[model samples]
Target: MKLRFGLQARFLVAMALVLLVVLVMLGVLLQRQRLVERESEALSSDVIHQLVDGYLHGQGRELATRLADNLANPLYYSDLDAIGSILRDQKRDDLVQYLMVFDTAGHLVHDGSAEIEGYGQPMGDPLAAAATAAAGPHVQATAQVLEVSAPIRVGSERIGGVRIGLSMAVAHRFEQRNAERLRGRIDELSQRHQGWLALMLLALLAVLVAAAWYVQRLLVRPIRQLAASARRIEAGDYSVQDHGDTRNDELGDLVRAFDRMSESVARHDRDVRRMAYTDALTGLTNRLAFRESLDHRLMLLRGSGRQLALLFADIDDFKRVNDTLGHEAGDEALLQFANRIREAVEKYGGDDALLARFGGDEFVILIQEGDVRASATRLAEVLVAELRRPLDIHERQVFLGTSIGITLFPEDASSATALMKNGDIAMYQAKVAGKNGFRFYSRAMDHAVERRVHMEQELRGAWERGELSVVYQPVCRTSDGRVVGAEALLRWQHPMLGTIAPSVFIDVAEQSGLIEQIGPRVLHAACTEAVRWMQLGEGEKLFVSVNVSPRELRRGDLPEVVAECLRETGLPASSLHLELTETSVISDELQAAALLARLHSTGVKVWLDDFGTGFSGLSHLRRVPVDGVKIDRSFVADLQRDPDDLALTTAIIAMAHSLGITVVAEGVEKESQYNLLAERGCDLVQGYWLSHPVSASEFTHLLARRMR
Candidate 1:
């Protein structure tokens, strides 16, 4: 029959071997203990003697060095009384046998005596030569004494030396006493160790027997249960339970903790999944979840002759609301907008439709069940109308509108990424045509988007390539038709595209954050050109008007930028005019007013450009600190025939003059328009009838002509 060596049996065998080894080791240890103790006593005596000798030497050296430093000044001054006093003080120590001071010539000056018997006598000791020659404390031991010598120096020159001798009698007695004590301790320890060994053998045997039983009953059984539970958890089973362990021990605590951890993991898994797929603000599907669903639907609809529509919606002028009000109001607006969109989608879109908040102020919807185009169109229309309704935010009614773009699957695009791109392009087309409407994706829209992207890329480095230049349009006194100043206009002549208009590239620059860089360059160029025109005018004060973008004004650096330009170009501040539109100032009237006030302090003029085109109210004129207003071309185009245009123009000039603001009419192409503006007391006029925008050199010629 085969015998099984279970845990208890193996433990018993191991314990027996250990007990046997312990008995043999104890016997051997007892036998060798006496010899080791005898040898240890002799070795300890030697070590103690050596340690005592070294300590005497170190003490002698330290005393000699201290004596040398004290005697230096007294020896230099030849004060024998001070030297004798220092030696006597050092000799008070019990270990110090003698102390002496020597001159550089090796003569003993003081030997710790009142009579100074060795004074001015040559040192006859063998160590005298080494003491005088050494730079630091030196020690040597003899049969009865330890001798130390140290040099005394004033600055870098050695003038004398000090010597000290310590007696060996006290050190020898101390060594002998320590050796006797050490022997007594060894004898006592040997007896105690023998008794401890016997007791340990008995205690170890008892513990081994008890451990075997404990392992079989408590440790092994609990460990096996824990291992089974771990295996279950590894196999995706999180339902863990404690097996009724009543012991208040680490094992019991671990079992309870494991159960809690399993429950926590299950709850966290659900929370993580929800957070990954849902938008926290709107409770709608997020972009990741929407994209995943779109891809899955596309796979199922493949080769099934079915279609799907993806619509992209963006809130129009949403940033304006955020900038004017706070983000809390913006969040409230978004929540309300989302609720309205959800209602509209439920009404128009079929059951299979999915809606998602793609990102900030942008939402996307997918419809795959019904007629894709018809359903998307109805949904887009309903969304636009419903969103246009005023929303109550912060107890104030705020109106919002949405622009949506629609693209169909298997026709406009096949993949999710491509469909999304086409939808975005179509949405931008709607904004460009006029916001608050919808547009369907077409090939032409894609091309237009490509061109715009291309233009933006090219505009980045156009200035470095020398493709940009400035043109000047002369502003003449309407009463005399004589040039007084010019408006600096930026023009870009692309290498491939002949001449790109400011309207096209200016918007691209602003959108791409390139205007902040380009705005300063234009300011500097205009100031530099105006200085030249001032020289050409022969003492006439000719000003240059530079257009400031709304983005640049919002940055609140216009005052500093203008000051820097004037400083660089040496242009007088009064000779530079900065032009801003009403829309730019109306966005943040307080900020604009402050910026304009700062510019006015520097003597630079601020003009409200494109007036009557936006917020043409008397309150705007009162709030903004403008020095002048420019009548937009739309008002000037029909100034000759249209009664309303003429009346509005007349009223604008009268209102501006009443407030001490000058009026300049733009787009005066006909003689009749100039005559009417001149009659209306317009201060300045610039249009095709007077002269087209010309190069700087050409404008210089006109200035010279006016000078003649």
Candidate 2:
């Protein structure tokens, strides 16, 4: 039957409606939360201000009324003492602790309670302090900030005002009411929203049921028919016809198209079978079908776990086939050679074995046997015997020998790649020993991986012998010819080798797992020196930045180290910056993201060092909090003369500004180079353009000279 709306269209509409409902719910929830927060803040502020104002106005009016009464109708010391006692009884209960009024002369006139009347808590005449329309009530002392001042005006004759302070004991009573009300309202609103959500979901359920029935009838039926036909095709039966297109809908059109596809599929399958199962030129079983057949045989023999020997055979002196008989004749010789290998394997290795052209002029065979060595020796001899056969190619009789490398499986490794690698290594050994022969693999190759271990041991000692030192390159600001920060670089001054370049030792440290020790020490030393200078009154407002490597960042405790160093050295976080290589940020994306997040949390500035050298520059930057980018010396070294470097520097500066990160150009060797960086609007410029690395004392002296 024809349908007005198809199953796919119904599904799309259902999904769209569900998503729209979800978005609306989320928006409504957020709006409600915002409104509640805004209302609570406004109410709390109004209560606090009104509480202070009411108390102050009431106390001021009472003080004035009592003082005028006391003056107009004389009172004795006996009555005054009674009033002081009354104020003491009332101070603790009401928020009004003590009320005092000062005249224009800073002399206290009327005091509320005896506790503060004589002690004098710095209350002067209210008339002396100028009144501003925008001034809000503020506290004079931290412990007494709860107290508030309310100004009172009486015509043009401004008199003294009262100051009343409320203790912090009433916080619970005031906040509990607001919180309870909010929770109740939130719960009620949540329940109503949940009911609305359930209604919407029930409506969606009806749509789902109708759509499921429609799909079962229209789309699923035709697709199910196609799936059955596909299974029949896979089972080598192409007799099924496409009956999916019995109607005029989309599926019916799909079924009509499928009928044409089956014929082409049958033709391609036949061609692929001939090409894949049979060796194209030699007409032997090709490697693809050969491996499949071997796997099936292996499955039957799974419990046996008997010895399986693999032999990797290579053409001996095969270059002669191409050199003596041209490439076309060489192709013919290779096919004939493959035929001979099959015949040999069949004779010595039996029909149960596997024979395949492993790759390029090489072939592999697997055999199951009780005595692996015996089978290996026989297989090798048979291959040598078959390869001795003569090939007649274009009126020439050419003879090619074979070199075979045999390795036993289950004794080596059960994995295919490992067995292949072992066989290939043995084949190389056989060829090296002498061609036209075969050799079995032995287990002595583990000793070959020891040289790398020895190098790591030496690196551990190098850092312990006072070999590590820092080189500071000034990162100067352009608006003025002043230095803002310095990039800390580590250099190793080996006793025997003079000065070693970082490129050489850095990789050694990374491979040797020495970065964990080296990275922290460098950062700590840099921070210590910067702090020492600041304490000595030499370096002020100078930030020292150290580079963090990926290995160290992952393995080392950077957050604790950064915090501890800042605490230990007494250096402010703003004075210490961390420069991370962009490669570190991109290598392990997740760890880089988490590590960068943690580092940023410690309040230290982070710089993407060597910014332009990494792939996914912009994407990685978004995943982390970055304060700046350090343009690598690699790009800046030739910027004065190279147009590409100049353009890149300009673009980097602009990109950094767009992201709100500062950009510092390194390797500015000349004044003109520095000028170019400054002209490009770089935030900082470093390198020899300012000054080379100096000792701590010399740097301090230089700072002193510059100040002079």
Candidate 3:
């Protein structure tokens, strides 16, 4: 309990003890003060004895003679007056302050008053209890006065008593005179000790307050903070800083220990949360967190009947950044990519924006409000611009870019995962169109994409299921309208989705790596179908042509693929032709050249399909050994209406003939176009002007009909 009361209380207790001692000392001094008066009585007795001796030596014979002469005529108090006069004239200061004379009956004769003050006014009280009839002087203190009395004898007559009624003035005056001298001595001592007590008191008080402050800071305040911090930390909050500071004291040590503890708790809490919901290095939301936020917002939007939009972004050449600049730079680029996404989100109002970095260079944002989300193209455009800017770090500038896809809620899907899937599909379209662009999700695109996906799955099942078929489109001569060759086009009569477009399904098959199987199937079928015409002697100088995509050409197995097909079908190499588009030749020029050389060496002709239709280099044309060029239908179809088409057609025919390359004009719908092509010395043509894309039986029947 004493410890709890603290130091200040202890100080107050100590002060009370000091005051009690002062009061006790004052009581002792007041009790001792009465003794000084007894000493004064002894002193007065000596004074009176000296006066009697003077009188006995006839020291004042003249005063006695004068007094006797005045009293002879019957003045009773004359002698008393004469004696008082004699005593007053002597200047006996202490002895004569109070004078009282008594006749033998002890009645007052000449008592002194304060008008004659000090020792001359009064001495001591008479007829009081402490005074007795002793031969010496006696002193008493009465209610009224201090009393001193002595025997007064005139020649043994014992005429009266000599008494003094003394006032306190005399005793006080004596004390004051002595005390003045004592005060001078005390002043001297005090000068020697100036500022000592007050300075000590101030210094003691300052020390106590400083000690209290130190205790509060190092222990009390820190303990309070530790309590508060513990509560916050317990509540899974790590943001508050512990304000207690360390010192070279025990309490300070304890406080430091607590700070370290709080730091540990906070770090562990953050790490746990991050492990659950955050990407460690990039500090973005992980797949799980993204799904959670996405699901929650999607549900909210569904309930409120509000729109939610999502944008998915993929960086162009992201693998190259990882491959060329190293993985560290790749990670930094991803960070920068995320930051750019965040900036774009800020414009859309971050409250409705749920921006998160997905795996690699992929990212997603969920938009809650329609105003900002209504135009995802604008947001994607901003993202594209921002992402393409240069990132300067460590004095090195690096360029990065992104392709974005936007999928709107309900237009795409109502669910989070569905929205994300739609965005992914749109992103693929963007990538296909070329990198560094943006595409919006659409129902038509989705259906088109879904058809392709179904076809891809069917193509995967093609070899096992036997669902692939080939139809022949004949290549005929423009001049005589005679069949030169028949090109094979593979078609899939899908079991579920009927007649999926070749444009939609072929690319999907290639991406799914089923083209290798499908390509040979078409080649083998075309060869088998066309071989009957030659063996039966039904047609002359006719060959089967098959288009090879880039996937097949890059396999370096075109020669092997053709050899395998020829071995299986028992067809001559002269009766076989292979067609390729401009992209197939341009993407892998040298490989296409070498592969075409081997195919040409085998006596199988090669044709360029859709010439002047793509961004292909003319240099690939000379390199890759090929026999013929087929003008795109677009050029031929517009030849009558467009002068530029006529010029382009004329230039292409001239260039093909100069290279010993045969030219096949694709669209010959009008007699004027045919006449123009024949005049230009175009080698061959295939269109309604001569014949349409025909089935193998139709072409064979036409050949039989034309034999006449």
Candidate 4:
């Protein structure tokens, strides 16, 4: 059980018990000494009475007759010198206060001394009266003396008592002297006992003081130190001094244990801080730490006239490696990448540069107190080179590259977040320029990013705001110069900025994921327009080819969307042709083929749009199940000017025809281009030579003209 009372309390109680016992012993000793004094006084008084009795009884009768005759007639006994001499001989005795004699008749016959007050008359003293009344050996007391009377009788008769007077004052004086002696002796004894009592008290006091010191050293002081240590721990000072190690006691053990606890607390605090700031996988500073470090560096550079540069290094095509090899391999690749970058930083930028993992596939670095841009660019080059080295991940060789973007303090950006953002923008510019490259941040890039962001935000609401529309560019048969179909091109008419071209917004739409929303609207509008065209009494079959974005194709819902558009517009699927770019259908070949086959089964014609422009080849025709290919306008535009263009276009037409695929010639504006395409047996031609892109109303008139 825990101690309910403190050490001091228990110690005080023990001392009090000892003191109480001592006091009880002293009181008993004093009372016993007082009782012995009273007993000794009573015994001395009895002895004094017995000695007086013997003195009176042992004296001879002659002494009594002489004293009696002298007392009977003091005038006549004035001649009795014998009695005077006897009385005078005992006058100075300490036991005798006075000496006197009385007649046998109890009358004063002769005064033994002339100094007697009632001489030569009857001695009417009370002692003599009591002695006479007693008759023989009568002991009586006057106020100051005891009188012993003896009858001078021959036989048993009493003559007159010879009264001998003894002083009661003398006995009282003796008793007083003895009592004083006894009191002095008792006082002496008490002083000695008092000395012992004082010693005992001193000893008790010394014991109490020693106990207090022991408790203070062994228990109180250690407990106080422990409490102080705990307070220091609470105050976050883990490096407390150790005070418990010197003694070989429980308190010392407790102090040592507390020291261990303090050490553990300090270690745990360090570990928590490290985990918070460092990445677990790579042991590099994490994003939060990066931001904090950047802020700190900027503060340090504020007045130091030093510049800092931040670099954002993004691993290019890391996703491909991750998806192909698995996440474990991905983690290993990241670890290796981190190691290489750190090495490059240490070599080129030194310890002043900070390296951290911003997150998956992205790392950041800061160069401080130096030529920021120049050093950063040099370090970026080295880092790119280092990261390009092949890594062994899960025993599989993998090659990776880095694109770095640099932004400087007080130049490209003034704040940490701004610097990081500018760096990110420049990094994206490097990716856009080409992977495995680096770029320094420019204000133009910042403006461009801002513009892109603004356009993205605008494009998201463009469909709902009626800013988006479909412009149909007529497609004609090259042989007859007649319109047979039109390609649906998207246009953005900004409410404030007038009309925007597809090139301006389509790229932004694709990047911002807004293209998915725009794609369905375009399909629906084109289908509705085609149905409207059929409703016009032109009496000709006109196919509407709507372009599809790659993002829309990758969505894997293009077939369903097209079917819904057809169902909503009540347009026959055969009349609605969905044109997909080569890049759109080539990324996922299986999904693209499946989606295309499904669309084909729905009686919808799938044309490969911008066909000779991308990485797709004639083999894609055999695999993608497309009904036709549109020759890119770049090839068609330079038909007469560039012989290579004419040759490539002619070869495309031949290969497309060989596959029994329809050939659509784009951007055929010149007569020479059109004549050459006709000579090459191109199936369809679309360009400004026939007509620029027109609204549905204008296209209706064109169809009316063609029907006429």
TM-scores for the candidates: 0.63, 0.38, 0.50, 0.73
> Which candidate, 2 or 4, has the higher lDDT?
4
- Model 3 residue 243 CA deviation (Å) reads 15
For model 1, residues 424-512, the per-residue Cα lDDT tens digits are: 99999888777889999999998898899999999998988999999999999977787889999999999999899898899888767
Candidate 4, residues 74-183, lDDT tens digits: the string is 32334446646656765556655555554555665334475656765776654556665665565555566665566645345444445566666766666667667766
Q: List ranges where model 1 is wrong by over 4 Å.
A: 1-256, 317-333, 385-402, 538-540, 615-618, 640-642
- On TM-score, the candidate that comes out on top is 4
TM-score-best of 3 and 4: 4
Q: Please give, for residues 358-405, the per-residue lDDT of candidate 2 as tens digits.
A: 556788888875586798898898788778677778775566678888
Give the deviation of candidate 3 from the true structure as CA RMSD. Answer: 15.9
Model 3, 1-708: lDDT tens digits are 445664445555665565556546544644453344345444554554454434322322333333333323222444545655644543255523445544444444554332333322322444532322534355554444455555555454444455454444554555465555555655555544444544655665676567667656645567667777888877978887866574787767877787888788788887888887887767878778999988776666675667767788898756545544467877887877777677778885356677777787788877766564555767888888888787653345555578888888876788777788899988878876776799888777788677667666667876567566676766667668677677778776767767767876787777677888778878888889878767656547678888887677766778978988888888999889888887556544555667778887777888998888755435456766779888898999888899999998998888788889989877678888888898999988777766666666886787666665
Scored by lDDT, model 3 comes in at 0.68
**Which pairs clash inside model 1?**
none
Task: Looking at model 2, report the run of 10 residues with the lowest lDDT sum.
Answer: 131-140
* TM value for model 3: 0.50
Clashes of each: 0, 0, 15, 11
